[model samples]
Target: MKNKLTRIICTTLAFGFLALPSAQAAESEFSLDRLVITALRAEMKDLDTPASVTVRTGEELKATGALTVADALQFIEGINMYSQGPYGQSAGRMSSEIVIRGAKKGTLVMVNGAPVNMNGLFQLDNILLENVEKVEVIRGAGSVMYGSEAFGGVINIITKKQVDNSISSSIGSFGRHSHSLNLQAGKLAFSGSLVEGGETGNVTSTSTKYTNYTGSEKISLNGAYRFTDKLVMNYTHSKDDINKEDISLSTNNRQQYSNDQESVDRFSFQYQDDTLLANVYGAFREIDYYTRNNDGSVPLPTMGGYPRKADVHTNLKTAKYGLDTNKQWEVRNNKYLAGITLETEKYEQNKVIMTKASAPASPVITNQQTGPFERNVIALYTQATHQIDDERKIILGVRGQKTEAEQGKEYTQLLPQLQYNEKIGESSSWFVNIGKAFRLPTLTEMYVTSDRFTGNPNLKPQSGWSYETGWKKQIATGAVKATYFVLDMNDYIETDSTAAKMYQNFDQYRNQGLEVSWEDKLSDKFSYTVGGVVSNPQAYYNRNWSRLYSRVQGTLGLHYTLDKVSANLSANYITDRANDAPPAFPVSLTVNYKAQPETTVFATVRNVLNRHDVTTESTPSSMSGYFYGAPRTIEIGVKHSF
Candidate 1:
């Protein structure tokens, strides 16, 4: 493993791209002052924030032709993105999910600096980049400033707010078609997109077995009115709909289809000045889903007398509301931010099953239950930053949260953090950060009951501590960075297959990792970026597998530009380090040509190697299940700006 990793890193450096570590520079041609907010919940210089952060500009994302935020995040280091297939392909466990530092459930996802992770599942695949300005990622515990579900890190998708207007359309492989538009006029901004497509061949089995198809549409509107130079009112609303087929869990032999519909509305009134900034806001999220399983063939009495045919239907609905207030003050060389957040969520589910046996032994089950499974959370947090000297600073923060669930379970938690940063030389700086973080069980994990799995109301929240240190160097061309981090976790929540297939507080785990990355512009027309990470994990969960993540992973990219053309070649590698290892090594190439000032043509060939043989075992029971990767595919698109 070490030799292979060394070869990968050496090969990348041989191409004049040295692999360093995490944290991204905010400075881009289209950004303002190179400022980021995910690290501190306030705008701070990219390299100055006392955390390991990474930023991907909207332009960079657009260049990648990624249909979703989850797709775009795969290029960064220290993050393990597992997908059954390319971008929109795959279902169930193969669907896209991110793991940072071997921590999957501890990540916090947000949009416009507000928590948007729904139902405690960290699925960000639905967040398209049509109107996003940038994505900021803070890799490490962030609960001290962002509250719960930040045990591993924070990912904040910042939308475009400046005045701008553009439109584009594209058609690609597998009957894929999409259209998008972004418009901004004075205080009003609107962006929307429509996409429809599915796999041309079978998703998993051969001969087009899994009937795969997916379609999604979304619209967002934001309006901000300046009441005065010191005050403003902002309103934002968004609606998204997704319809697709669920390949179902590999363990399930049933074919299923599902649909998800969601809508969100937010309003905020704010007051800001040189010395003070405050805001009051209210938001709501409504999510609805429907699923049906079709098993057309039934068994006869001669064939073991199993159910000849069966049909299952499920419906789930959730409503979430949030009210929050935040205020910040600046006193001399000291800065302080204080905020309070209140949230309430309610969920309901219904299921029905009908089965037909060989003879007169037919059974039907209908379970209709309305839990209004409720959850209420109140949190208060404050952070202070003090400049110790000309080149040194310290940050201190703390947060307290009270949570109440419908099951009458109540709990309170406190998170604290400390960080120090210093300038070592004219072009180098270093930082050390330590923090405590936690994640409360989601409503689904606590109250939802299903035929295959049961919820445990007694499951406790997972809490942990993280320690991180890093050094960064700003060079004339680009930059280099390296980060080392460790996480000690307790009361981890995982499915227990030992008995009734239930959720439980399994055990504890420790993860230590190192990351190094570098990006450089060698010339006016050539640029390259490379990064790699190594994670060592120890699991004490009484499970056979000690680590569920790859021991070594890396990414490399080379880009070239001409007056009217641009091209990029990238590669990613993941070492099989888990007990039931699933390794991936995919390479891709992309090119864009500006046929005219207002028109551009693009082509992308992903998985150019066509290496889809990667496989892994099933979960929970750890049975003989199999998972694969996306096959090689090509896509061509054209866009026109208006």
Candidate 2:
């Protein structure tokens, strides 16, 4: 593993056209003066925030023909966008999930400065780029500023506020078509998109087989109005319908898998000025699903009786509302920021089953039930920065929170963070940061006790300490960022596999890693970026820490433009994986040309290398119980602005 990491790093530096670790869009530069808000609730320069950050612009994403955010985020070094095929091809896990430092549920997701993660997970494949303005990612613990579910990091998706009118359409492989529209009138701005498509031949593996067709329909709607220069309101909605029919070779059965419908709605009102920023918002999410075999087949009778057909349905719904506010003050070159947050979430689940076995026995007519749960949280947080000299500064921050759950005992905590940064010169600086992080269990993880799977309401919250140190330098046309981080976690949550076992608090685990990246322009029409990460993120399994992540993961990208034509090539290589790991290497290419002053044409080819990377896995073994990657496919589109 060490030799492979060294060789890759050396080769990347020698090539100069590196896929730098910073996933910034080519149009963006990590300059010291760039403004960011995810690291701290208040606006601050990248150099002043003292953390590893990356930003991707929506314009560049659309121009590059990225189908969704998941397509672009896969190239970032520290994140693993484990997905069951882009769009709606495979239903492996639940949705497109982002895992940082081996923690899947520890990443906090937000939009426009408000928490948007619903029911412990958020869907990324449905968020088209047309409605986004930019994405900001802070790659370390943020629990001191944000209360819970930030044990790994924070990702904030900023939607477009300024209106730009345009209409676009596209058609791709596997009988796919999509359209988008954006318009502005008076004080209102709107953007919406619709997409549908899939292929039967693209997703398959040597052991598992996806013989039939899989497809999906996706929609997004967003609108905003400005009441005044300092006040604004916005509403965003998304819906997705997915279905797939496949042949399960392991079971030797023909079955169908799907999440019939998934949707989200968000409404927010905000007031912002030079000294204060506040938001009041409400959000809701629903996921409905039913799974059964293609034919009406019943389970084999266990008690010497005939079996009968069955119908089963399951659904999950959650409603969340919150208020977040921040006030800033500057005194004698020092800065202070204070804020308060109040939030409540209600989670409900419904299940219905109908079946009858044994012809002479009494048949159950109907079965209906629900799981109801609620949690309320209040938090106060503040940050203070003191300048000891022109080149040195110190930051101290803390958060206090009280949480109450309907099915569990009340909990309270106080978390703190500290950082110190010093400048070496005008273009370089180094910093050290230490903080505490925590993650609260989801409603399903705590209160949903059942026959097949049991949940324990008394499970404790996972808590940890984070230590990070990094250096940043603005070198010539681009920049360089290097960071080393350690995460010490205690009382990790684990679910025992014993029959009808419950969720429980287990032992300890740690994640430690090193990251180095660079992005720059080589000439007037060409550019390259390179970055890599080496880490051994461990998970507490059985009696000890096991399951290390991919030891060496590197990103690759190159962009070229001349006149009205532009092209981009991107890929990722990962090796030294877990348990008989299958090979993983996929590449993508995109080309664009300006046809007219207001019209543009583009083409995108996914899986350019046609690599048979593993997309979905059922076990640790590589020989079976898995699905393959997206076959070589091409898409064409055109956009016109009015």
Candidate 3:
């Protein structure tokens, strides 16, 4: 499919902005008093932005009993997590996955407005809820403000700088345990956590073959310093290590291997002031894969079939460095924004192998290496807002991206966005957003060829447009919002159906959906949040359509507070997905008691019903059970503030 329809929608939206006079801004999806930063790329109340955005405060985060940002994302309406077993570390290449509307390459995750979706993986694993200030979610295209990867949505986790001093500890099922500390002294503050867990089960096996996950270790640290009232500096670092055992039944004598250690390390420095926000970050992720038995031999991935020929050890690593800055100014009823982004990424791989023969295998090793392949990106963007009248407003945004890479030709594209917000009354409002979205192929998809994947340097990028319209109303005791969105994409990227499955581009894909959410206070000390999504996501191939995943997903949360105790219960529901899979329902509860003015005790329960079924597949439509949800786990911890 071509992108001709996008031009039509863009023209229509531009006409609506001029013809529709009495439009500006009005209600909030959460509360009228709430402020959203990501929706507009600046500090503005939710009532003033023409986007579907959700803001979760620090207090509300604690109520959900979530230790990490990924845990809480699982319950959000249009978001999904395909974790192999738990949140931090899992068993496979695509483990601990996060996607919006089942598009893994579309959503972008950030910390304080800095992109951290390195190597096509979400970067939220290092952020602890305790050190967060707020989380902002913007659905639909955000390429105008961010970059190409923000095609589906954007998740921004804002951390607290000067936090209260505290120390905590907890222990739970499957040798799960953690320790954390947060402290602030004058203008300096620091927070960090160490988590460890062990699990041995059928987390990734599909044919009754034996599989085991030995253990995983994770560490996260954050620090900040305020040099002046309007200037601050921040630093973040995280490390992860995972160990597992693998066995392939199709191989001779059921060949075996051990994941000696699969690890990732990330660090970043951020600088912020009244007029500017910037970050410099780096990441390193590697996997030490080795085969066991049979003269250290393993099956080699081939076009015809898997052949047991190479005795190989694999090492894969990705290194990234990025810097993005934003500058803004105000002139009467208009606000202008100018920004620039620069990033460089490299993919490195090393394979140590020796071919095996019938009699004996060579004792010498043959080493194969791919370049520390580099890709550089340069982008410039701007946004301008004008108040048409007392109750009407319009926004214009655009971005230009230039790419120079190792294999593909030099590529460049421009993305533009238009928005209009209208105020209906003192308590209700409506808005419309029409924009362009895109996604470039990652290095792994174009440069790295391994045992299971074939690279395609000829792959083209994916391009599309997003159309969204929403309305918000504030009731006496609660707020309600409804959003309708559609996505039309061309040259949709996927794996080809050949003996050697190389990455390829498809004809077209379309996704449209409706989302509804309501938050209310039932009583003086009781409240609830409800959200649901109805969507039909399908791909067009060979002039036919096919479903992506479940068509319906919903969430429910109940909160109660009285005296010194508070409790929260949350639930997620999904209809039957593709490939004869079963429906999914996962629920959790958190209870906290303020033992003293500076101390508190809390307990959390996950997977209350313990339904250990297929959580997600390798692909959106695959039936080869690749992952499952986390089992029931209990944790009790105490926190003391000094």
Candidate 4:
């Protein structure tokens, strides 16, 4: 009761921010129509980019009261937050996955222009939304500039480059608590955050009965230094630990437990001048996993029967070093970019599994493996942009990539891109783009081994190509766009369920989609946005529809500001999406209110329609059986910036 009152008081205090005096530079108003897009690897206006792009500013995200980067992206068109957790809990035993335009395994997620999404880990929980400056989502092929894991699209998270000194604390339902601090001094800046939270299961349902307790903790630190006019450096470190306990099968007492922990460290140095740009970076990532399953059928020591306990432990480490350089030149009506990148990565893995034995305390190690491998890659790329006339422009780009592995065959690929943009009117444009991309198999997917799955050393790289055409119109108060895209892929990798869950290349995969969106200011105090994507994805060999690919997905958002108070409401809906047994129609809602200039309160109610449909893949033989869809949940929180 006391805690509830305290929360009310905090919320009340936050709402009081509106009562304070308003200060601004001439009370000038900013419009979303003025956003300029730079995530296409070039400086261009949103309507002139020749691709489908969505930009979410930090201010807009903050208004939604999302705690993590992934949460803030839920409303983006074509993005499927595959698993938002049961209830409002964001952390599960495994990382949350997202599917874009019917492409589940081909998305690339980056932070400050660095790749952080690794094999099988797609969540962005490590990066807090509080530190994010903006998010850019490119909904098409990006391999020409971003290399592997980019066949679907690219999600670029930009962190705050300038942070004012401040400290803040927040508490929410589901026992969520967090504290953060940011400090800046001249050329040096530092920021850090710690979050602790979890969920308690619902008691009324069969699925939620024993599948309740989930807990997680995350810590992150970032620092930057500007040593000189031409030299700058930045470093970031983060750690996450998650725990889950649930019942796999409802008929038995088989309780499942899992613990996953990860740590990442990265450092980058950059040099830039008029026509010369260079960067050197190093990164290290490590993960530890432990899982235990006990059916409780094993008799106690006094009963003289073996305990039915099964456990597995795995440790994986990866390190990467890379150097990149780019030179820009201009000649009359033509501009060119020439770049080269060389990178080397090392990977090591250790795994052990224990099964039931005569001794209850100590089980026999039934499976064990140790693997260490390395990969080297070099890429050369060049791009040219020519202005033919005031109404027409064209871009041509090409990249050659080569990869060599320590214990596998070498691979090479030549990717190319062509784009054209034409001005339709003073405030509208039409564009088209075609590109090729490829992704090499990761070390874990190529060398790791376990009871349920095995890696094939001879796995081949996956290659694909995509084409898109779009039109955009900017009105007096907002913008609208429509796009049509198609993807053709070959040598796509997948698990051959007929062969002990080994990985194999699927012959061909195809996807075609249409995306449309509109955002406008209805009035001086109100704004609205509506967008959606519809796609058809299929595998040629089997002639089957892709799993979990939604045929129709959409989002709606509304914002209103009156006097000192502001309110925001947004919802996302997905239809004809498959995960476990049946197709699900999932919808989520978020509402936020600002009480003060630096304080706000928000509530998120996911699965508002009470659709308990599963949102993840499930397997019976391993710890994956615990994967389930999020349930209807409501979370409320308050934040006060100081």
Question: Candidate 4 residues 1-642, lDDT tens each?
Answer: 655754664465346433334322211243544443333465577877878888887777665556677766767777877553542233432466766777657788876666666554554765666677788888888888777778888888777766767777766657767778888888887888987767645311244335655778889888878788777787888887777666654554546666778887877787877788787888777878777765577543222333432277777777877888888899999999988889887778777776655656456676555667888889898889999999899999888999898665698989999999999878999999999977788776687765567788898888889999999898888889999999888886766655477777778777898999998875666677889888876654333435535677788776666555455556676666543334555444455556777776666655555555555532222223334554455666665666
lDDT by residue for model 2 over 1-642, one digit each (tens)?
655754664465345334323333343233434578889777776676688876667755554457677666776667666666553222422666676766647788787878877657766665667777888888888988877888888888887676779999989888778899989887898988888877545365445655444777888888989899888898988887776656766775665544467787888898999999999998888877665444326443222253423245667788889999989999997989999999998888777664554665544446555567889999999999999898899999999999999745788889999988888788888989899988888877788866655788888888989889999887787778899999888877766656666777778768888978787776666666677878877767557666654666787767766567667777678776665557577667777777997898988877765566765422142124445566666889998999
What ranking emerges by TM-score with the best candidate at the front? Answer: 2, 3, 4, 1
What local lDDT score does residue 197 receive in model 4, on the 0 to 100 scale? 67
Total clashing pairs in model 1: 8
Model 1 spans > 4 angstroms off:
1-33, 84-95, 200-310, 355-365, 543-545, 577-579, 613-629
* Better by lDDT, candidate 4 or 1: 4
> What local lDDT does model 3 show for residue 122?
57
Q: What is the C-alpha lDDT of each candidate?
A: 0.68, 0.73, 0.74, 0.70
Listed in order, each prediction's TM-score against the native is 0.83, 0.89, 0.88, 0.86
Candidate 1: tens digits of C-alpha lDDT, residues 1-642: 655754764465345322322222321242212577768777777678788877878767655557667777777777667665446432322235567777866677776665666576434554556656888888999887777788888888776655357777777766667776667666666666666655433344332234344665555555656567776666666665655564544534446665556666666666666545555655555555555555435333222343422244455555555766677888999989888888777777665655544566555456677476888999999999999887999999999999999758998999999999998767778999999888888787787766566788998998889999999887888788899999988887777765566888867867898989888876666677899988876555556445665778899877666667776677778885564655777676777788998888888866666665443322325333334555566778777766
Task: Mark the 10 consecutive residues where model 3 has the least summed lDDT.
Answer: 20-29
For candidate 4, give the lDDT. 0.70
Pick the TM-score winner.
2
Per-residue lDDT of 26 in model 4 = 15
Single out the weakest 10-residue window by summed lDDT for candidate 2: 301-310
Error of 2 at 180 (Å): 0.9
Off by over 4 Å in 2: 1-33, 88-93, 201-213, 250-253, 257-259, 295-310, 356-365, 449-452, 616-624
Give candidate 3 regions above 4 Å deviation. 1-32, 88-92, 208-210, 247-257, 260-269, 290-312, 354-364, 541-544, 618-623
Q: Report the lDDT tens digits of candidate 3 across residue range 27-71.
A: 112354468888787788776779888788766766666788877
lDDT of 2 at 466: 87
